[model samples]
Target: MKMTKTPIKVRYQETDQMGVVYHANYLVWFEIGRTAFIESLGFNYHDMEQEGIVSPVIDAHMYFKQPIRYGQDAFVKTWIEEYDGLRTTYGYKIEDGEGNAAVTGSTKHVIVKKESFRPVSLRRVFPDWHQAYSDAYKSEE
Candidate 1:
């Protein structure tokens, strides 16, 4: 499976008095990774929103493997773990400078109408995007 790695510089504001990154910050990293993944495919979220389509996260999960400290360089690795016609699950891993995973996560999202918040199928609204996601998806096998 191909994963896009986005480099991140840990900032003091993202950490606590203990110098360790706050747990919630990992979610932000996940988002950054997700955006990078989408951009890598030549698509941007702003264009989608302008087109009346938006994807909202329905589920989120994270596993902390190790502590990340302020001033450390980290990388977020992202990939399409699964993609169906209506939903997409993205996998994420945050690695420290030494390439050790500091956190692992996944987020599930569904496409929706930006105005009404009504669920929309990617297959119906964006066939090319759907096909691209399908092609990038990694199956359990």
Candidate 2:
């Protein structure tokens, strides 16, 4: 797998009274990781939007392993776990500064036409981007 790592400094706003990161904030981190992965592939979500394509998360699964406190530096490692013509799954791992996993998750998304909200195949809209995802996913096997 070709993993892209994005470093994040846990901000006070992301934590609770106990100083542990709020559960919902992990999903935001996942978005950050996902955006980074797409950018790393030489494409970006903004361009997709401009082309009238939108990718929305259809499914998400997360596992919390450890607590991350405010002021801690963490990293989100991301990779393309699966990608078909229409649906793509991005996997993510949030690790503390020491490389210990604090959370792991995956988000599945499907490309859609921005106006109609109908599902569309990435291969049809962006062949190069689709191929890049396929190549990256196959590289792990």
**All models: lDDT?**
0.91, 0.93
| TM-score of candidate 1 on Cα atoms, chains taken together | 0.95
lDDT of 2 by residue, 1-141 (tens): 778999987999999999999999999999999999889889999999999989999999999999999988899999988888899999999999999999999999999999999998898889999899988888853
lDDT by residue (tens digit), candidate 1, 2-105: 57999998999999999999999999999999999998888889988999988999999999999999988899999988887998999999999999999999
Q: Per-residue lDDT for 83 in model 1?
A: 83
Once fitted onto the true fold, the runs of candidate 1 whose alpha carbons sit more than 4 angstroms away are: 138-141
The per-residue C-alpha lDDT of model 2 at residue 110 equals 98
TM-scores, all models, native as reference? 0.95, 0.97
